[model samples]
Target: MKTNYQREITKHIETNQLSYLFIMILFIVGLIFGAMIVVSMHFTQKQDLLFYLNQYFSRIDQQEILNHFDLFKSALFSHLQYLIIFLLLGLSIIGLPIIWVTIFIKGTFIGFSVGFFVYQYGFSGLLFISAAILPQNLIVIPVYLFAATIAMIFSGQLLKKLSGRRFIRFTVEPVSQYLIVFVVLFGFCLLAALIEGYLIGYYLPLVRQLIN
Candidate 1:
């Protein structure tokens, strides 16, 4: 049986399903755009990227000792930085477009990375991506998308109030709810960081072999 809190949350989701769908489509479009850009890269550009990528992998190979703590810190800090930005963006009307851009850019970068990996190393690259990238992103991406969607909805509410929509009061209730949701999302970010920092090392040998 669902508690009242769960019921309310479900109702809210049902009400905002269209917004979620729209944001998801936007992210997917960005991903496709990124992959397409990879396809269109000039040979010289690809070579430059390949050179850097090989250098990076070589460094990692040489440094066989991985610092799990440092990786965790890096991943957690990165997630928190973006979450803070979304929090600020949700506070104002002009931030809606910026939030959209942030989400799109995130998707684009991920797509481009995956595309480049597969382009360069064939099946091995795909395996590396599945092992190293997907595990963390399986949690991270949804958390971010949820944050972006919530930010969008909050900003929309502010816009409504600004436009003299009397029924939609810009009250403490929404603000508190927004903060609470992000706080919960932050916990998920920590889980993602753990995966990125610790879980990926389990596949270290495979990743190194693929890169080389």
Candidate 2:
């Protein structure tokens, strides 16, 4: 016999699967929009980006000019901004549209980042993914997706509350559970931030060396 915990987990998964799918589809749309913008840009612009990339990498290797600490700070700040947006959307009652927008913006950012990298570096840009995006994003994207889905789910429940379909008793358990979920997801975001700060810098030099 399945325990109550097991059944609850299964039920949540089944219930949220469609919502997750809907969010992912929106992300895909955003990702495509981002890539399209890069694709349609002028060749001169692409060359400029290529030149800047080469110059930046040369500085990193020969001059040791890139401040890893500053890079980490920037990366962490960027990530925390993402985290805060999703967290707020997930916890708020009327945040579904914003959540979708966040998904699109995130997709656009990644699509542009990856697309521009490839456009500038050609085959070599693929190597940059190993160091730059692959590591942190591997953890971060899934967490964002989960957080978004949870936000949508919560928003739906809140709608039900408004309609007098459920939670009419004003119980503390549900609110406490929502807070606990946020705490756990925040901790996960911190973990991703640590990886961005410490590990990604180590990967960058190695990846650049291999690609060059």
Writing each residue's lDDT as its tens digit, candidate 2 over 80-197 gives 6876776677667789899888888999989888888776667788778766778778887887888888878887787778888455766788768766776777677777777776
Give the number of the best model, judged by lDDT.
1
Model 1 TM-score is 0.94
Candidate 1, 1-212: lDDT as tens digits: 99999999899899999889988998998899888889999999999998887787776777654677888899999999999999999998999999999999998999899999988888988988888799989999999899999999999988878888466544688789999999999999999999888878555655778655
Worst 10 residues of 2 by lDDT: 63-72
Give per-model TM-scores. 0.94, 0.85
Clashing pairs in 2: none
* Alpha-carbon RMSD, candidate 2: 2.7
- Cα misplacement distance, residue 17 of candidate 2 (Å): 1.0
